[model samples]
Target: MKQFRLHKVASVCLIAAMALIGCSSQGGEKAAPGTQPGASEGSGQQVTLSMHSWRVEDTEGYKAIIQAFEAENPNIKIDFKPFKATEYNTILNTALQSDSGPDILQLRPYAPGISLAEAGYLEPLDNIAGISAFPKDVLAAATGKDGKVYGVPLSLNSTQFFYNKKIFEQNGLKEPKSWDELIATAKTLKEKGIVPISFGAKEGWLLSLSHGVIAPASYSGSGYIDKLLKGESNLQSPEFLQSISRMQELIPYFPENYVGLELNDMRTLFATEKAAMFINGSFELEGLKKLNPDLQLDFFPMPTNDQKAVITTWVDGSYAVNAKSKHKPEALKFMEFMATKKFGELFANQFKRISAVPGVSTDDPLVNKMAELSQSSSTPYLMVVHFAEGKPTTKQALENALQGMYLGKLTPEQVAEEIQKSAATWFPPFKK
Candidate 1:
């Protein structure tokens, strides 16, 4: 039984005060060359450390962090590179296997962390400084089955149905509180010639958002995933099947070529007010803000058939050190810098990420409201947290199968059976 505790954010004034106070041991001191071995010293024999991440929006945020870090240690240079979200894993996998990976790697803790750590490509960070600042459940996500910490969590993410508040108000549309109401609202919106939802299904990975947003309300308190893993239940259960049907019902409200649209396209549709609603994780709020600061946005949990709305959240975005990096010392120094509370503040305030570090708060009003919703009723994203180990995991299979459903090539029952079939290969005796 993993506890889900939503740590409250500290005041912005307090965070700013702390940043000015320079509490971390690094403080504001520029050391001489070789003063701290791997750290940058004033003598300026620069140590360039490369980092790889999937967040393009984080470029400026990280640059600010790097600037602060370099202020104290003038001899180190950080080379940060961001890859496309869809192509990141493939490129990272190749780089790691060839011993040509970045010094610092940003990754998702579940499947990717597990695979890289198992292959000895990620360095365990059990001794990382300031690690105790993170909540136990948050830290646990980045720890492997072998009890070694391979990554430090950067954010705890929550996904909800983000709707254009102004659109809803202008159209006389009330936020739906039940699955049936949701469909009715969509129908009404479609009647008025507006896209009801702006979900992008073309990016294979984005398909999971279709169901992930619905998983919490459908299965959270039931210990459903645990039963499936222990072989006491399966995806074919009536309850699970019905959940798939709930997602399929949204197809008619989407764009005709919804399967051809990528996530960016969906964001454009919503931010441009072409779509009334879209399901997205909190990470997108910052980007959305930049896209249209005047865009009035609000969110509600994906309404369930049973009418118990629960926010689906996951511990997402972690930083891992490459096991074979020649600049381990420099990389470790940067990791220590990230562990600081000030870095957490910067992450929350500047990058618009829900910081994993304690006592950090965002100034964004919408983010704070979403955080409150998360605290009120939330559950971890199921497949990301509970899938049995194997290729084509339940997460992967669900994504693929849902894409079929979006294309009208698969029924809800077929989707359920497909998931069971995929899980059966990894967990024996899976129900048919």
Candidate 2:
């Protein structure tokens, strides 16, 4: 009788459990087609994705952007992690190689991004609905050699001269219209006990950035770049040598002991009003503003002998999905949102950068001026945009040679020769 009673109790419990499961099935929402087995869009199950970037300074900006994304996707959350810029590549590569990277990551533009895709670390974004909105040139930065788009272009960066408006006004200076005028302005600033340019050579990459700002106008912009790409010209060409010489000429006006200084030191000099001008990329605007909110800043492209200025512009970076991510659908949804105009506007307004997405405009007058300048006259940032492929890339060669030149270990001619030799070793057109 006791055994019979125990079996009756067991049967009643089983019936209760089945009734509860039936209630859940009848009342709960069904999973969306093609979704994961237990989780679906608006199914009340939340997912968190990890994202990594090198823009540590933009932490707050990204937080606000993520907040907006999360609001639209209540079931999804993003955790953004940014590492120091100098250390990011190594860290990201290590994580990716081990298949332990974040679900999404910020990619370096052009060859660097392509390499990640080629290594099978990145997912191809060809089928993403929003990728079609970007221009081909913009898309090229994140495209692999196999013709797959691996990321969404984030911003178009322009390298130029950023000047303190108050300093220029106090020094009785007008914007220079030619190379000679720029030299004269620097001389006047130096005479007034002001550092004419807040520049440094400690970091090799900045040398390339400075070159992008100063060289394009000297080489006649895209025309010269095309010649170099086709094997019609080399880095040792007179125009290219002239560009190298221009960098040498600016050394006298640089901050004292500039060779020992890094990017932050250079920025401090300018932001504190200890220096009159700085040659840097448009991306520095937000950081400079954050350093000194009262700073009065403006920018101008470096001018050529012919008095025409061409902005050196390139796609700065992109956001890519990791191929090893377990949450590909959710990560892809975030990527699709990033490619939208809404995200573009949010990015531009928050970061004060020129959005790669078309039709996204900024209210900041200075940023607007940059956008206008880009549209009117621009050239690809030569080394990074075109010659950044192969072992010991031309970009790397130029950066190293430029650093040597700054330290008086190499002359402009020698720097040019070294770069030419490096490019010839791997660049197909140069080999021909």
Candidate 3:
């Protein structure tokens, strides 16, 4: 798995009770004492270091790089544990609670990391030498209220609208530039029996992202985002509603099992040619191309009501060391290697996503277009349901609302109420 190959996202029915990551890590070469000034003093000090990361199936892809690290530092060996995509978050939390977890972890920025940071599972990064080179915005992201950095963001992957070039050409359609065009295109695709949009709203968070980033950015104008951030505006403003209303109107244009799909399933449907377009982050490009090398995939800015569409950035992966790790310095060294310009290019060019580091040319024609369209991205971890105890609530409310809307159980006004309730809980103002 060269890129993120999240094969399938199983039903979230058991999400409440299930621990994430079904794979157990075992059977890797182990050694120790080959690293650090003092650790190396003991010639045969064996440290069978095991670590956990989300979606660990990238064994073969990470092979070359990890092997190089191991070869250079002979005494330290790494036992890599891969997490199943569907169960990663829950399992990672469980592992982090116990002292027996992996020494390092791959964390999501907009999720429930504050709990772990406060629990003292994560190490601070203020003194890390290479911290300055990381994306400034993303660097700010890993900083928690405890005044310590919980992680180091590796790449910034923005979300957008992915449409099939061949399909657009065959239908004599151009990429939509405004909300009206998007709706018109959906209507056209519907007549051809193609699902125009593919989002697993049944999973809730994916649907929220579409509504949160694309909808708001398109209708209210970019200034609206800053206003909301400054508390001059709230999500329930007319602009957000207008954009969300347009998104909701497309319920009839998605796949048949829209009520039963999740993120990975929706991507598979698009990759297998079951849908004409998909809206998602950049992590999927490599795996998508692998499935169909000649698919002619091109993404365009999500059509907003505004003349200029604003890009919402989501930094995909963040790396953090364990607070209790005996080898903190080496871990920072690894973080340094990951933050360099070299890693940024490897990430962007390798994964076909936006890079977080400065000075990295997204000069490749396709990547350049994505970069050009990405105006700016900000950090707001305090909001977004995927962040904490708030997720289950959002998932329930959103899943119920969308599923109800699709099934004609809920009215538009009713659905709006349920979403607003959740947003309020997640975005309450600081009371200092």
What would the per-residue lDDT of candidate 1 be over residues 1-432, giving only the tens digit for each residue? Answer: 122353222111111111111111133333321443444444456788899999887798788888988887676788999998878889999999899999999977565565677677876666667876676667656665445566788887888898998988888999899877888999999999999999888886777765778655566533565566456788889878888887877789998788899999999999999999988889888888889999998888876545667787777888988877776667777787777888888788886767877777778777677666666776667676655245867788998898898888999999999988887775543643
Residue lDDT tens for model 2, 224-311: 7767656889889999999999999999999989998999999999999999999899999999999999999998887875678888
CA displacement after TM-score superposition, residue 29 of candidate 3 (Å): 31
Model 1 residue 276 CA deviation in Å: 0.5
lDDT of each: 0.74, 0.81, 0.60
List candidate 2 segments past 4 Å from native: 1-40
Give the winner by TM-score: 2
The lDDT of model 1 is 0.74
Can you rank all candidates by lDDT, best first? 2, 1, 3
Worst 10 residues of 2 by lDDT: 1-10
lDDT of 1 at 188: 90
Model 3, range 1-432, lDDT digits (tens) per residue?
112111011111112212222211112212221233444324655554565677554555455545655665565666777787657878887776776567777876534554566566776655555666554445544555334556777665666788889888998889887777888998999998888987776665576566655664544334554555445765457775665566677777778867778877888888888788998766667677877887878887665554556555555567787765666545655666566666667666656666666667654566666566554322121124222335555545654676677677776667767766775675443111
In the predicted model 3, the residue pairs found to clash are 20-87, 20-91, 21-87, 34-75, 111-387, 112-387, 218-304, 218-305
Q: Of the candidates numbered 2 and 3, which has the greater TM-score value?
A: 2
Alpha-carbon runs more than 4 Å astray in model 3: 1-38, 41-48, 56-59, 362-364, 376-400, 423-426, 430-432
Indicate the TM-score of model 2. Answer: 0.90
